[model samples]
Target: MAHEELNRQVRQDLRVTDRTSHRRLREQGSTSREDLDAVLRAGFVCHLGVIVDNAPMVVPTVYGVDFVSRTLYLHGSVASRSLVRAPESTVCVTVTHIDGLVLARSVFEHGVNYRSAMVYGVPRLLTHRTDRRGLLTGLRVLTEHCAPGQWEYARRPSAKELAATTVLALPLDEASVKLRSGPPDDGDGPDAQLGLWAGVLPLRTVWDDPEPDPALTAGVRVPPHVSGRGHRTAP
Candidate 1:
């Protein structure tokens, strides 16, 4: 019940700022925190947009979210310049899931069905030596986000390995959420008289059967967490 109330409060209108305000496609924009969480939970990969060396750089990386703390965790190699420099200035993290292609009678009316979220903030870097606990937590969240149960099932990272990793925590205080779904809008327009077959081509992601490494022992069986994942649809 407490969580429910907290959710209700968070679901209220999100704090809108110049960066988060919707200037166009106002109909598809959402200010509800629930909408933002849905967009983040639907995918693990995100594009981190930041300025590196005075040039705009976009890096694709895996991410995880902790709603309780209202933070987004992103990880990468410590040697990566983009990750290192991201803390120097504000950054934008975007996650998008393409649901379908909206086929319309007219070319101008054609569009795509997608759910997207953009978060803007100045992230704080978590170094393994200085912030081991924070780094581990971030890594676990990231690993589990990509492959549920893998973090506990697999061996934990060693000190050297952790030292080479870079983790960034970005607050979820400011964001923009937009979702577009359903059929083409030209159905009731003049283009409707064209009699063209216009509809949505839906897309889905699913996990395939797991393949074992060649060096693995033949008698070893697949873990339940993994074997059960096969043929399952991804969010």
Candidate 2:
């Protein structure tokens, strides 16, 4: 999507407006649906923020996004007060991945290198069965990010289980992305003599060996995707 179309006219006042510093990086923080979808698809976990009783509450949960529909799907238990209280208000969804740690010669220059995306919009309740089914598929995409084949192997949710869960669809408008990478900047004259180890310590997320359920019958093989897993793509 075009930048103009994605951010034609956003509200002047929003929580993200304050968090959005650095105009150049903010522009790099794309509002395009494709960018948002890529960030969402690259990972399963996200931090969801909503107001409850006029106080800010942030909860970590799984999320999925549909670029075509420009919708973000979130799932939580029916008993979750955060979801119940957030229907009428705008919410912020954030996805972040720490790529590396930047260690400088001086302690003051130390920082974390990361890639992150933030999305803001009002969440709408899903009612129509067709839309609900689509949202459920998106949810499955999140739940099985590392192991795509598990969606079929795992027992599907029953009717009662579905009813007890709350699924929310939020628009993909009013979003931003930010990223920082590479080594630290130490001054040329003063720090040249301090031969300290100043470089990036890379971090990565990988799949560990699968642990099957203890009660499972013997001879059930692990799924191909899980067995042949490797490092996930960074957002």
Candidate 3:
């Protein structure tokens, strides 16, 4: 009951509103906050859609999620034009995980099995004069988002490096998640009699054996978490 209550509360807290509302193909939409969280946690990279010079720009960058604050953090260069323009305007951040290829009898019916989330908000830029802790937290999330156990194993960033980086946090209050995963829709349709091949070919991202830095000292070995994901699909 406790878990149920928490889920209910999260749902209420993250209820989708206008603008973030799903329209066409509503069957592929999910209102569950848990689903949104899962999509965000599955990937570290996100395409940040913003307007620069009155033109649309979609910049691919690393991201981190602060579920506690209902925020998504984006990392970019301090001098990046898109990053500079983002804070001044409402930006859209999209994260997607492709699960498989959905092959159908008809080409028009073919699609991809994917989980995607789109979030819109005004971003908060973290700087030395602003929220330094937010930057640190964002970096931590970015590191852990890419691969768990890496943050602990890696060297910490220095002041100069932090100064060169920009962290932008966008609230997750307005977002939409759309996903599709299943056998092809044509499986039982008129095309079924065509006897064409139809099914899902799953795809996975995995960590291969670690390649040490060329400058590393001899005798070092791969860590457990690094090696444990052998042939294992990475989130």
Native-referenced Cα lDDT, model 2: 0.68
Residue-level lDDT of model 3, residues 1-235, one tens digit each, is 9999987787655567887778888999988788899999888888988777778878888888878888787886532446565446888888999999999899999999999999987888876557788888988877777767988998988889888777887888888899998988987679999977889999989867777889978988888877787777766
lDDT of each: 0.87, 0.68, 0.82
Worst 10 residues of 2 by lDDT: 9-18
> Which residue pairs overlap in candidate 2's backbone?
none
- What is the RMSD of candidate 1? 2.8
The TM-score between candidate 3 and the true structure equals 0.89
Tens-place lDDT per residue, model 2, 60-98, is 887766656667777654314565655567788899988
Query: Which stretches in model 1 have alpha-carbon errors above 4 Å?
Result: 1-11, 78-80, 83-86
Per-residue lDDT, model 1, residue 27, is: 97
The residue-by-residue lDDT of candidate 1 on 68-129, one tens digit each, is 89989997543145656444678899999999999899899999999999999888888787
What is the Cα-based lDDT of residue 61 in candidate 3? 87
| Steric clash pairs (candidate 3) | none
Output the worst ten-in-a-row residue range by lDDT, candidate 1. Answer: 77-86
Best by TM-score: 1
After superposing candidate 2, which stretches have Cα over 4 Å from the reference?
1-38, 78-80, 83-86, 127-135, 144-146, 187-189, 230-235
- Winner of 2 and 3 under TM-score: 3
